[model samples]
Target chain A: MTIDFKQDILAPVATDFATMDTFINEGITSKVALVMAVSKHVVEAGGKRMRPIMCLLAAKACGTEDLEKHRKLAAIIEMLHTATLVHDDVVDESGLRRGRPTANATWNNQTAVLVGDFLISRAFDLLVDLENMVLLKDFSTGTCEIAEGEVLQLQSQHQPDTTEATYLDIIHGKTSRLFELATEGSAILSGKDQYREPLKRYAGHFGNAFQIIDDILDYTSDAETLGKNIGDDLMEGKPTLPLISALQNTVGDDHDLIRKSIATGGTSDLDKIIQIVQNSGALDYCRKRATEETHTAIQALHELPNSQYRLALEKLALLALNRIQ
Target chain B: MTIDFKQDILAPVATDFATMDTFINEGITSKVALVMAVSKHVVEAGGKRMRPIMCLLAAKACGTEDLEKHRKLAAIIEMLHTATLVHDDVVDESGLRRGRPTANATWNNQTAVLVGDFLISRAFDLLVDLENMVLLKDFSTGTCEIAEGEVLQLQSQHQPDTTEATYLDIIHGKTSRLFELATEGSAILSGKDQYREPLKRYAGHFGNAFQIIDDILDYTSDAETLGKNIGDDLMEGKPTLPLISALQNTVGDDHDLIRKSIATGGTSDLDKIIQIVQNSGALDYCRKRATEETHTAIQALHELPNSQYRLALEKLALLALNRIQ
Candidate 1:
């Protein structure tokens, strides 16, 4: 796994993504200063830029030399994704994200929620500027699906008897759909129909792996790395895949405690629940499944011609899977 | 004021509007249903559907034979407006709306916020399917503008020293933009470009009058008629036009108390403050201005051909001005 991680691949793509940054920040121009300050506060806090990078990589791997459209789409994908996070943090009542106080915690819930809306709408404005009706529809549809998925998760919280099929559906809607659209959208824009399905397959597989690893990180990472306390999910009563699977296998007090923890939500002994999850081996089981998905993701990339960009994408998938392991 | 409020005019329009409810209500499509139920709960609570009706009435008045696009756009406008209300209630943290629990109150703040996102996105989904790129762009732009307006309002809330100019700007953003767009958009879709400017003028004037009358209603209406309690705005520390104007004209503790009340929010003496606003003649003053705007709005309708639809449009504006008197 000692593949060269090209700093350049992301740096240039990152610069191009700044147009989205500028557009979102510029949305406040009519008011002067406020929009810029709030938007900059959130955007400056860095992320992996994974979704945008996926768009760039897919566009490159599909052998489309023109990166301009891919660049904007990448930025739109990232902004749309960021908008969701801002709103999600408010919904989760999370105080911290990416090592900083959330917008809701810092300013107020109203500001955070409104800023999130601004970003989401700004994404659509940018998408429309591309003058591609189909892409616009896909991005809009993807956002609606993501919101529905997040709501589903919120509604299903603390319901101990949740099914595996329900969990999978949530994951697909919340995470995979956007990934599928990001890659598939780039391919479509580039007129690379031959690779669109495979690229979508690749993106979906990668997204599932990424989300599983995200859940895994919740269990394994400390406050410094994960930017919040570990077991925060359990405290919030979210029945993430690993937690749900572990609950099914636990016996007696362990099971009851976990269920009670979820039911009471924020009143639970999170430490005890975390230990039960670790002991149940469910975390390892989920990681193994995620690794299998990573393989499937990489396999989809075989449809693309061999290139440095494609390899970078493949390595990124492996990197996600490795994080879980 | 005693002019007949007919079944066809008020009740049937209300019933028809309610009947055309095409939100994501629950059924076989359970996921869409959940999203819709949360949204419809907020919309169906008998709050005024003024903006959508304006869209419907404007199209018919414009001499356009096609009512289908008008109906769809009317629904979309209502959906958009409802989505904003859901988010606004969360932002305001109010418990009751339309004399019942708000979406955030019934289902936690997160689901309410997410449901807003779903409805707004669904509006675009409807617009995109119309096969008109320009209309899609218009709707999307209006959505972002609405978000921007909400953000601006959030930044300005509870600040009593806000000038009349800023007050007008906030109202224009928070209310008039939707009105302007609803009518202007209908005009665009109905191929009535000659009427776009005049219809926009009509919508803006009508919206201003509509909102001012709404502010007056806070003082004049009871909890039962207005749904939610009266002076909820004052309680929330929002300085609507009437209060803003009153604050400027009054002196000493009258000014000081208004400022303090706004700064502290309506935590105490809200009833006394309502009395203060009424005694200061702010409501009557606002009503006079609203009547002036009503006349201007009626004048804006001169561009439309003579018809019953045009008369209805004129009467709606007059109704708004008279509602609070």
Candidate 2:
């Protein structure tokens, strides 16, 4: 079931993604300097451009002749993603993102939120030209699902009773849905149903695995490679799956300490709690779960025809898993 | 034309808008606690519910038979507005809105942003039920326009070079587009073309006057009526039309001081500058401009058939003009 992967898709896709940012710029008619500053700052700061790459790769994989449409869609996805990030930074009260001061932190929260909104709105406008009503429905639904996921995560924050299923629901809403839609949407746009379902499933599983690994890295990664402070989740009071798993498996004072640490969300005792979780094999357990999901993710690609895109996607899943360790 | 403006339309619209908070409970699958908390916090907080009310009133003015659709649309508009606010508060670093601790301030920025995204997504879900592709298109476009407006506003924050035309463009993007959409969307949803164009113009002008009045109120309105500290915008360094126009009208050191105030955002000499602006007749000038817009707004409604909703809308315009004073 392994597919051949290549980085060529990466370069052209990256280029197109760069070009897609233009769509966001096209209808922005305001003379607001801060809007331009924050928007340009966020976009140019550079993310993996994962969503747009998925759009282009999916479109190419589906054997679509029109790269232009895919390029536009890809840009819209990135804009949407960036918009969410601007908003997310504010939500997290994050001062830094992708190694720079966040829009909210750098300018103010109002601009960040509004700029994010502007981007989200622009994404829809970009998609409007594609002339597919169903795509609108799918994208709109994805936007909402992402939001619901965020709310789910927020609700579950600092609650010891938060379950694995609830966590899964949150991940699905916040991360996997958008990932799944990126490929699914590309396939839909290409009018190629043959590869659509499999591509979507593969992307979804990969996204789930990806976010799990991200959560793991939050515990395990150094600041240099990760580009963010390790244990930021803990500091922010987010009880990731690994932490929750450890809490559930603990006994006596271990359980008491875990509960208090999570409740306090990184007091002086946070170091001790991190050690307890590390020793408790929660990290190992979650990492194993992520590995299993990664395996399942690769399996999800079985229906897609062998191609560089398919292989690259499989490699992507593996890279995500390996990156956590 | 004077139209009969009824409290029934507004009252029930407000009630339904209020009830939407509990509607999240209907999403039985997610973390109910989070949903309840986010929804309750957002809904219970005071808002003008202007967009939704516009939708309702527009429908009523058009003599639409199906108030139910308009009602749902109203809820959707409010939800969208709420979502933006959730994100906006985080971006603005605003601690209070309408005299209540903002969602971002009360919960955390992350929760506020995510919850806002969730509500936005939920809005699309509601829009989907309306089952009109055009409505979705309209809403989606409006969403983008709002974002563009926001970005424009952000970009314009400190640039004293912003002209009247530029100012109008920013205001239209930031505020009026939604207002116009709300009125016209209601008419469109209700299939009332006769009122649609006129109602849209009415809403646009009204919203323009409304925002100008708000900008003027920043200097003139006391903390109690404005529900925020006076000159908060000035402190934030947001150069609204009053300042921009005043700067353009004044000469020499007065202009230089105002420009510097805009750049430094009224930090030092806040009172002295406020005095200078007042003495320079900026407040009076802005008020006069707002009143002019208000008159034009009222004039736009002349084409609508005599109805209570139309009159309420007209009164709303007048109220907007007079509120700051």
Candidate 3:
């Protein structure tokens, strides 16, 4: 069955979501006018607030009543997400995000970079206020891994020899780790130690599936539908799953073409690459892998007592998978 | 009395300084090859290690014999400083810092931005290991302010209406705040609550004096002496104290020229603006202000008992002031 996001997923925690949204606005307030302005611009440009919703869902899934702290944690998660996106846009030289002008485009790279730093520091500042040492340690170490993941992605750029294992490491760092933080952190804050591993596993696999679907879209989705063009990843020589899988399945000319495309990034061979990516069964293999990850993620959810929040999270994972279908 | 940096300033904590330097190398260890390579390059390129030295001296001044924790704190301070410098190079688009290639130059902006982020997270990760909540709060809050200060400086860039008070706020955030962190963090780590405020004040004022002297040298010092070109700040339309003071001391043609130079950044008017800035008595005014700030920084040191460490701290402040003389 098709799922409506607001009704099926966000509806259960809609009030907490609203509170968290407001808190994000309140949290980003800075004495510096430029910081406040740039931060407001980027945070407002956020998409769906998926990570925070996951945090709230995990909190409720743990059967916790008092969500005052979770709401703040959700806002902090979004802030960290927004901060990373700001830097990512600067790194990617992206002009627009979700149809809005990016922080770098709105002001300049300097403003974007510094404001991103402000958001990170502010996020940590608020985290310190949570007064939970365990949460602090998790976040501190998680952010480091997240950064290492990003640098690794950069290091892998234009290299065609990157492996599936390396690709998993990349997605885990760049995509899934923050998701784990959102859910596991909720478990930590809720004082539910037992739920931590399951939630982390659920988020990790879900994050991996989510990123795989995104990389899949980069080779398939139209700009109007996805807000980013097809071949965008290939254009940067980013050896995402599709390109990596395509290399593995093809041989002779097809293999050489994929390697050349990754080595010399551009969309000049876009149509040809897309046709090969599909014809060679890379997309099917990618879809199967994503489905398997989604299944594993859903399976991990069974560790928690069955509830509406858990079902909503399960539905959230399914909704992500449905995008490929 | 000529203050020999080695004998007068670093002499008291020379052994500790050497240990702290080793800690920085050890502290920057990363699993990622690129993170390690870039981090090592920047940390090794660091000059004088002023902030960490201040941290070591402050710990000694507090009569803490076990310099173990203090050494780690000192290393953390340098890491934080290095992180900012990495980002600052990206913001300023600087190629070389202290006559060595910047991270941004050695790698790329994307690498620099990400590695800079890794450094920040690593610093906090190590900080969490310190197990001092007070120290953590100070650093988290201080980093936010530092970022805001950077944004504030960017906001004021080329505006020409930036006041001395606003300028002080900028320097306090961008420059002095870290210095404050280095010294105050020492007090926090040493379990010496009484020394925290005094150390923060001393460092704050000393930072102001040092930056002011640096700004003055922007119009005075040659490339060989300062390792930077003259009028570099004016080239960026930075309305530092010299230009602010120049505006105060001139009118009509001179005032208009300085204002235009600030509003429209470039080195085309370099000689003309330099001549106007010097002849307008702005340099003398800036010198007086730097001297006043140095005196206040020294006065704050009186709160600590007289010891070789305190004397070294005093000498450090004086040595910074002597740069202008």
Candidate 4:
């Protein structure tokens, strides 16, 4: 059965999603025109607002009816996500995101960097208004880990010897940590302490699965499929799961080629590398890992009682996995 | 009367200053190797750490000798300041800061941008530990203004139409907002609500004076004294107070040259512009403005009780003014 994203995933919390979108617009209010313009560009360019949707779902999954505060929290999560993406564009020196010109590309790098800073500070400013010390601490610590994860990704770049453990560490920080914040943060704000651990586990595994699938797409999916060019990761010599697993499964020439490609960071041998990555069963290994992660994530959601919001979250994980299948 | 920095400004809080120093080192703890290295490089490259020092002095001026939490706040302020500097170096593309190789120059722009992000997140993480909602609100708002200020400075760059009012707004956001956070945050933490307005006034005026002096020195200061080359701002086409005042005082060719130089940033006409700025009496006008700002900042300290710390805060403002005198 095909699970529709709008019907299966976003449907349960559709009203909350609208509230979240409004909060996102209001949250980015700034006196500076450039800050507002660039923020609107990046925020409007957001894809499906998945993170915020997840946050809304989590709040409802906690069995809370009033989502006034959860809506704001969701908006803050999106702003934080947008902040990372803006800076990520600058760091990657990429001109496009989601097939649109990025903040750094539209404006200069200086504007992008500073505007990104504005979004972060503004997000935190709005967060302080929530007046939840526990929530504040969670977000503060979560954001720090997210940044460290990003730096670690940079540190791993152009190194083919990066281990799977290290790759998980990187993805956990860069991707899953924010997801944990969204889900677990909803639990915290709802005063559902018992739900926090299970929600965190669900989000963590889901984040890992989501990122692993993304890395796989970098090698497997086309620009039309994912809004990103294939071999983009290899262009930067990022030793994502495909390359790392490809190394594990291969011997001799293929292994040496993977090492050289990561160390040198170019797509000159892209065709040959993709062939090796495919023929060596690295794609199969990555898919298996992703599926296991998705399963673990769904299992964690079982700790929560039966509800459509929780089921939507389960379907969201399935939708991500469907990309691979 | 000489107002030696070590003797007059920092001496009053020397013991507390040491405590704050230790907190700064401890605040940056991270498991990521790259984050640690880049953070250490920038934090160690910190200048006299005047923002954090002001925080300490402000705390003591409030008559609170138990400085355990205040030291943490001071460290948080310095980290925030360092985070901005790291991003500023990226924005300006500076190869060196404080006579040391910048993170961008040493590692790369990607490293610099991501590590700068790590610093910001870590700073907020440490801030959450302070556990004061009022202080958090002030910092959160102050940081947004700081980022807005930096963007305004960029927005005003090369326009040659920037007004003194707009310039003040930019400097207050970029410079004084943090200073206000440092001092007013001290008052908030010290539970001295009455001191908040006065401390913010002191910092706001002091920041304006400090930045004006720095902008003036851009044309007047030598590399040995300031570790920055003169004409750097002109090369970037920044419409600083020196140029703004020069525009107010001149007409015809001299006026046209300054306008053209600001609109088209380059040091090709540096010598002529410098001569024009000096002969235009712009320097004297800027000196008057700086002196006025400094006087206002010092006067704000009169609200707090007599203490060596208050005296030190006053001396620090006077010492900044002395840069011109």
Q: Please give each candidate's TM-score.
A: 0.92, 0.84, 0.99, 0.99
Candidate 4: tens digits of C-alpha lDDT, residues B260-295: 999999999999999999999999999999999999
For model 2, residues B88-188, the per-residue Cα lDDT tens digits are: 67657889888889887888776776677667767777777777766777777878777767667667777777778878887887788888878888888
Task: Name the weakest run of 10 consecutive residues (lDDT summed) in model 2 chain B.
Answer: B21-30
Which 10-residue span in candidate 1 chain B carries the lowest summed lDDT?
Answer: B21-30
**Once superposed on the true structure, which residue ranges of model 2 sit more than 4 Å away at CA?**
A1-31, A60-67, A93-96, A105-108, A192-197, A221-224, A248-257, A267-275, A305-308, B1-32, B156-162, B192-196, B221-230, B241-279, B305-309, B322-325
> What DockQ was computed for model 3?
0.91
lDDT score for candidate 3 against the true structure: 0.94
Range of the 10 consecutive residues with the lowest summed lDDT in candidate 4 chain A: A218-227
> Compared with the true structure, what per-residue lDDT tens digits does model 3 show for residues A243-272?
899999999998999999999999999999
Q: Cα miss at B84, model 2 (Å)? A: 3.3
Candidate 1 per-residue C-alpha lDDT over A1-325 given as tens digits, one digit per residue, 9 for 90 to 100 = 5533446356435555566455444443435245556667776664777787888888888888878878778877877788888888898888888888888888888988888887777778778878887787777677778888887888778877767778777788789989998899998899888998999999988888888778777777452455757777777777787778788889899988877777767734766767888899888788887888899999999989998778878888887766554
**Chain B TM-score of all predictions, in order?**
0.89, 0.90, 0.98, 0.98
User: Residue B278 deviation, candidate 2, in Å?
Assistant: 4.9
lDDT for position A47 in model 1: 78
Q: Write the per-residue lDDT of candidate 3 for residues B213-241, one digit (tens) a residue.
A: 98998998452443477888988999999
- What is each candidate's DockQ, to 2 decimals? 0.64, 0.51, 0.91, 0.91
Q: After superposition, how far is residue B248 of candidate 3 from its true place, in Å?
A: 0.4
